[model samples]
Target: MSSKLRIWVTGASEGIGLGLLQHYQNLGWQTVGSSRRTQGPTVADYWIPADLSDSADQISAVNQLMTEVGWPDLVVLNAGVGHWATADESARSDAERVFALNYWAPVEITRLLAQRAEGRGLHVIVISSIAARFGQQKLATYSASKAAVALWAESVNEEWQGSAHRIQLILPGVVSTNIMRHSIGRDGQALGDRAGAHRGWSVERTVRAIERATRSGRFAHILASPGVRLALIMHDLCPSIFYLLLRRKP
Candidate 1:
């Protein structure tokens, strides 16, 4: 692994992506951060602009970068949107939008990169949520979308079994970020205030874990917080009990 490896971070304008960029920069790594709206810090050697939701634009952005900077050693698919809704309250359009960004977009980008970097040592990092481990009340759509991403990563990892490219899935528990404030709820409301109360891991802590995992070349699914790890173990040990505890109150 190169000390000054080139990295591409999607959703780099804020949240975990932004924190990761800052941390990597501090470690003297060259990075390119992408976002749909805000431009990333110019301090980065390259800032490839992109909107993951826009498939054509995202492909073009990557092509442009490859023409200029060659293929990135690591690509962090960190951009995502969360929407929570009860099964009965969820709208078709809401589910469509969530799947488009949270699942399809990353899958498309990963496919494109894998095809282009056939024999290269490429690492693709996916930022899935711990909610993916099991369905959550009022978070059906979000959880399902994350589950799709996680399963996709697992499939891709298997497909690249004898290849140099690798896929990594990161399951992060609740983090104090603007994503909570922006996440849509069952009744199309924001969960900003409510999510703040569910304390788990800090963005810095998750970012550090991501860096460590990437450096260690670990391809297995990773849980960023101990709470999530414990929850997963319990869920596996006693599914009925776990489901009962996770059931939503009416």
Candidate 2:
């Protein structure tokens, strides 16, 4: 058996997943990165080129990983997709695609692995977002999807307590990534650029926060800065007033 700690990360082609994979690799851990992209620049000691959005792909990828790497010490179900559309506009399209990848797929994959594993210690880290706390204007489905994952992680954590199985949810605020590129604005154009989506926390900074939380064995980690957390707190405490004070658009 490999003496080094091994971790499997999904959605490792770009953004937070790529960042985390590289960080662990630098720390000398055996890292596996899974994504639809296979030919381009890749990190980690191993790569599983598969699209997690498809059930067959998810199954094939996990089975291949199991065959090649056996049981990983940690599994990061970071594969997700985001869209920016209002409820009215979203009705025009099939929302199930987003829901399937962002919510159901991760839950299914984790459940399958947990059920199959024969008493091997496992820690699952899932990427959620601060948007999950409540409904956001341009993030109706995105928010709901993340919220579903976070809630599931929490329930699973409780269910597996005092056992080797564990789940950790990392909820991030706005981070600089391509996710914002696909967002539709209130003006029917791209919304991310105007909202300063490209100016949020850096990939490295966000990864640092996640690592810190993992070391502390916390159940949840919100990757927003202190100021953002305060705003969320104010909104939670007085949502009506906050709603009146805040604007739906940038």
Winning candidate number (TM-score): 2
Pairs in steric clash, model 2? none
Candidate 2 residue spans exceeding 4 A from truth: 182-197, 248-250
Candidate 1 achieves a global lDDT of: 0.81
Query: What TM-score, computed on C-alpha atoms, does each candidate reach?
Result: 0.89, 0.91
Clashing residue pairs in all predictions, respectively, total: 0, 0
The worst-scoring run of ten residues by lDDT in candidate 1 lies at 219-228
lDDT of 2: 0.82
Superposed Cα deviation of residue 116, candidate 2 (Å) = 2.5
Lowest summed lDDT over 10 consecutive residues: which window, candidate 2? Answer: 182-191
- In order, candidate lDDTs are 0.81, 0.82
Writing each residue's lDDT as its tens digit, candidate 1 over 1-250 gives: 3447788888888888988888888888788888876556764567778777888877887797678777888889999988866889998877887888889888998888877885787789999988888867678899999999999999998998887888898888777778877687765667777654555668898899888888775765555556657768889899888777667434
